[model samples]
Target: MWNTLVSIFPYAIAYTIPMLMTSLGGLYSERSGVTNLGLEGLMLVGYFASAITIKMTEATLGINALPVGLLVGVAAGAIFSLLHAFASINLRADQVISGTAINMLAAALTVYLARTISGSGNVRIMMGIIRKNVPFLSKIPIIGPLFFSQSYWTTWVCLIIWALSWILLYKTSFGLRLRACGEHPSAVASAGINVHKMRYFGVTMSGALAGLGGSVILITYSGEFNGTVAGLGFLSIAALIFGQWKPLGILGATFFFGIATTIANVSQVIPSLQVIPPVFFKIFPYVATLLALVLFSKNSAAPKAIGEPF
Candidate 1:
């Protein structure tokens, strides 16, 4: 049992980081009164953008290309999210429909572009971020081994981003205004704040972070872009709801789902886990999400004006 736990812990953390970042992105959008259901598509766009960029630059730039690819991915997602921002904020289109359209368009467009450029629907990269120990930190006892050993640098980067996001959203006046936009745009607008601009910032942040999440998957575990994120985007949305739209809550929720997913993926190889059917593990996260939603819906802290066009 100990060995199994130790072996899977790192993988769970890796899986959780991406979802954590993406869910945090959702928090910003929802807090600013925009419901960004297109997180999955935004992530895919980032994933593909990173893949193509890394594929083209790796040979000439070596490992440096990895960071470059990540930047490209972030930029792509931010730019792509403008489509949603325009439709939902300016044109006042139904946010849900616009987000769904983003998903469909991303799935189709990425694959088509991949096939055209590479003659294959998948784009593979030759190198990725290497895992390393945290030196003295890895020397700690129980906590050290589980958290610090064999970790990716991207994990720390994401965590830093998460920490900063919390401070930004909770401690800053700008964050207060953004949150106000979600809860009562009229009130914010009366105060002379640009509700539309704040909402646009929120949506753009979602796209950027979701893109980062997707690229993290590519550079960490997946190392390729195959035109899909295996529904992780929707799962991130679930995490957002499960976490009650808070950064700390998002961390815990995404980690729980990450562990469940890791268990599902590795269940076949672990003797104790194998006793339980793999399907059980596979569906556990989604089931838990549904249960969380049902249990928390009445008391949900979702913005009062969320999904409402300002």
Candidate 2:
């Protein structure tokens, strides 16, 4: 039991980070009154942009390209999200429809662009990937194996982002305004706040974070662009709801989902679990997600103006 627990912990962290970041993005957007459901599409653009960048700059940037690729993804996600913001916030289009268009366009566009640029429809890079341990931290007996040994700096970055998000959303004036914009945009605008601009900021940051989320998955685990986020973006939305739209709550929800997700993939690595049908493990996590939503979503509270345009 102890060894199984230790072995599975790191993989859980790998899966959790992306969901954590993307859920945080959704929290920001929804809190600011724009229902930005294009998280899935935004993440795809991020993955494709980062992957293609890494492929092109392998020699020049080397393994350091991971961080650069993430930045590129952030930009790509933000730029693509900007279109949704314009349609929803400026044009006053139905926010869900705008988001769906983004999802549709981003998915098709990335595949076309990736195929055009790579010719073989795959973009991969050898960026001198290496994993290192934290010096003194890894010396700890039980804690080290569960944390420092198998993880990358990306895990720590996600933890820091989660912490910062909590502080930014709950303890800052900007957060107050963002929350206000979602619950009562009229009150915010009447108070002399620029509601439209706030919504734009929220939506843009959401895109950036979701892009970074997708990039983390690529750099930390896959090391290639396979042209899809594999529904992680939608799962992040579920995580946002499961967490009840709070940072700490989202953390807990993503952790559970991440662990559930790993069970199917990691069964081959554990001898005791080898007898279980692969199909059962494959379906388990998704079923769990559905059960979680069905059981918990009705009790969930959302901002009053979440999908409302200013």
Candidate 3:
């Protein structure tokens, strides 16, 4: 049992990393009075961009495509998120509506562009194009097997972002200002802070982080672009809510979701658990989400003035 669990640990980490990135992104946007309903759309853009980048680069450059693919994914997510920021922060549109619009736009755009560029809506890249194990640490017994077995760069990047987010949200003065702008923009404005500007900064940062999550999905898990990225974005939003808008809390919630998701994915393969149908296993994550919402809805609190326009 221990070995079996250890063997599956890397997959759990991989699953958690994407959720962590997206949940952190949600924490940023919601912490600043913006409801990022478009996380799904932004992730979709990153997903497609990463897969397409990898495929194209591999075909043309004949080299490792992971780095370029990740960059493209991040850029695509960031660009798509900018539209949401413009609508919600600059134009003062309804935040929920703006996010929904962005989601629709991303869905349409990704499908159209994928079909146009690749002659199909799906893009795949051959594996082993860019594989790297940790130096000496990867040789460790259980810990190494669990963490460094088959992970990608995304896992480390997510950890760094998580630490940085913790610092930015808790220890930094800028984080204070950002939170102030979200909880009480009028108060922040009275203090001579540009409320709108702060909100915009928060939203953009959210988008970028969300994009990074999408990149992780493309590069680490799927290695291709498809419709799979959309659901995870929504899941991130749920994770953000579940975590009550704290970076560390959100990271924990993401890990919980990731573990459940990983278990669901591998349940069919476990000989001892073969009696569990794959369909039921696949629904486990969603079941957990529903339970989380029910359990946390009353206790979870939003920013003081969240959803109000500046």
Candidate 4:
């Protein structure tokens, strides 16, 4: 049982990183009074951007592709998110509607670009790779393999981002102002803070993180880009809800979902668990998401001024 568990731990970590990034992104947007329903679309854009950049760079420069891919992915996510910010924050359109539009646009644009770039709707990556493994610490005992061993930059970066988010949200005045803008924009505005600017920053940050999530999917886990990134954006939203919109909470939620996801994919390989059908396990995350939504929807307290234009 220990060996089996250890063998699958790395995969779980890999899956958790992207989910963590997305959930954190959701936290930023929703916490700041914007319902970023377009997370899925944003991620799709990031995925395509990262993949295409890597492929193009590899073909043209023959240099290390991972760095190029990472830069492109972050830039794409930030750029696309700016659109959401402009529509919802600057234009003062309905946040939900703006998010929806962004999502749709991202999906459409990603598919079209992917087709144009690869001559198909899918792109594969080769050569440059983001490997998994910790420096020095990976040499530790059993826990090391489960946590530190064979881990990608995505995993470490997610952890760092999670920590930064927690500090920013709970410990800093900037975070307080951001939260105030979400909960009581009028009050924040009265205090001489720019509510619209805060909202724009929050929404843009969310997009960048979501884009990072997409890049992680392409560079670390799948090493390819396809439509497979579609449902993950929704899953990340669920994770945000499950985490109750807290950064640390999101990490826990992501890990739980990651474990469920890994179990579903690897159940067939475990001889001891051959009796369980993979189909049932595969549906676990979605099922859990539904349950979480149903249970938390009534009690979840979003920012009071959320979704309201300042």
Candidate 5:
């Protein structure tokens, strides 16, 4: 049992960080009155660009490639998101339609770009990966083994970002204004705050964090960009809603879903659960997601102007 837990729990943590980060991304956009359904596409852009960067620069940078690659992914996601920002925010286009276009474009564009640049089908990054144990913390009892050992630096980075996001969204003055924009943009504008600017910041931040989340998935777990994020971005959106759009709630929601995500493989590894059909395990996570939404959606209270064009 101990060995089984060791194997599964670390992976659960790995999966949780991406969802947590991306859900936080959605939180920012929705909080500022922009409905961002293009997180999937933005994440694809980040994942592809980061993986390609690591692959292309492997020889020159050696051990330094992934850190640099992360920045490239963030930049790519932000740049690509400009189209959605312009269409939804400036052109006053339907936010859902604009986001849908972004998702479609990201899927095709990443694959095409990857094939063209790498001279092959998929983009893979497999150089100088970092998986390290936290120093003194790893020396603790059972807690250390579960949380601190066999982890990536990326996990720590995401945790820090999570805490910072909470502070930014709840504790700061700008946070109040940003939240107010979602509830009442006209009131915010009347108060002399630039509603448009806040919304822009919110949308761009969503792209940036979602992109970072995608890169995290690649570097920590997948190590390859196959022109798809495997629906993790959509899952993040679910988590955002599941968390009730709150930062701490997002943390808990992602952690729960992350465990659900790994159930298929973990059950196979465990002797007790191997009797179930493998197909059931494969479909369990998504089914669980839908059920969770059904149970929770009626009670959810999203921002008043989340899908509205300001």
Candidate 6:
């Protein structure tokens, strides 16, 4: 069991990072009062954007194309999210309906564009971020092997972003205002703050981060865009709920789901796991999500004014 865990730990972390980014994005959106059900669509947009960008530039830019592709993905996600932001914040449309429309539009639009550009609904990349062990740190006892060895550079980058986000959202006055927009928009407006602008920032940040999550999938384990993130985007939303909308809580929740996912993916090859039905592992995360929601929905620490237009 120890050996198996050691071997699979890196892969679990790899899977967790993208979901973590996406879930964290949801945290921002919901914290600021907008319910962004369009995260799945935003992720798909990033995945498609990054795939095409890398495919077109890899020959000329080599590994340099990876960052370029990621940036393009982020830009695409943010731009695409504006549709949701405008409808929810400006037009005062039903947030859920607007988010659903974003998801539907992204799904059809990305595949159509992919086919138009590549003659198929899929685009493959030739390169990805190479994994490396942190020197010295990797030499530490068990902790080093699991956390520092065979890690992608992107993992550290995302973790740093997560840390900064925690500080920005919890430690700063701006974060308080942002959170206030979700909890009491009228009170914030009475205090002379622009609730609409804060919500816009929150929603835009969610899109940018979700895009980064999608790009991470393509450049890391996935290496291709097939018009879906295999529901990881939705899974991230579940994690957000399960985590109680806090940064540390999200980290733990996503990592748990990631480990569950890795187990399901690798179960066929592992002797001990082979005895358990693959279906069990496959449905574990979703089932757990449902249970978490059933148990916590009433007492959920979600933003009070979430999904309501200011």
Distance from true location, Cα of 256 in model 6, Å? 0.3
For candidate 2, what is the total of clashing residue pairs? 0
Supply candidate 6's per-residue lDDT for 214.
96
Angstrom error of the Cα, residue 234, model 1: value is 0.5
> Lowest-lDDT window of 10 residues in candidate 4?
127-136
Residue pairs whose backbone atoms clash in candidate 4: 132-151, 133-151
- Which residue runs of candidate 5 sit more than 4 Å off their true CA positions? 276-299
List model 3 lDDT by residue over 188-304, tens digit each: 899898988888777877777777788787777676777557488888887787777888778887887777777777887789767877777556656766777788777657787
- RMSD in Å for all candidates: 0.8, 1.9, 2.2, 1.9, 1.8, 1.0
Using lDDT as the measure, name the better of candidate 4 and candidate 5: 5
lDDT of each: 0.94, 0.85, 0.79, 0.82, 0.86, 0.93
Candidate 2: deviation at residue 254, Å?
0.9
> What tens digits encode model 4's per-residue C-alpha lDDT throughout 2-108?
99888889888888888788888888888888888888888887888988888878877665677778778878997899888888887888878888898888877
Q: How many backbone clashes does candidate 4 have?
A: 2
Candidate 5 residue 103 Cα shift, in angstroms, is: 0.9
Candidate 3 least-lDDT 10 residues: 124-133
Candidate 5 lDDT trough over 10 residues, lowest sum: 281-290
CA deviation > 4 Å runs, candidate 6: none
How do these models rank on TM-score, best leading?
Answer: 1, 6, 5, 2, 4, 3
TM-score for predicted model 1 compared with the true structure: 0.99
Q: By lDDT, is 3 or 6 better? A: 6
Ranking 5 against 6 by TM-score, winner: 6
lDDT of 6 by residue, 1-310 (tens): 8889889999999999999999999999999999999999999999999999999999999999999999999999999999999999999999999989999999999999999999989999988988999999999999998999999998998999999999999999999999999999999999999999999999999999999999999999999899888899999998998888999999999999999889999999999999988788768878887898889877878889999888
**Predicted structure with the largest TM-score when compared to the true one:** 1
* Pairs clashing within candidate 3: none
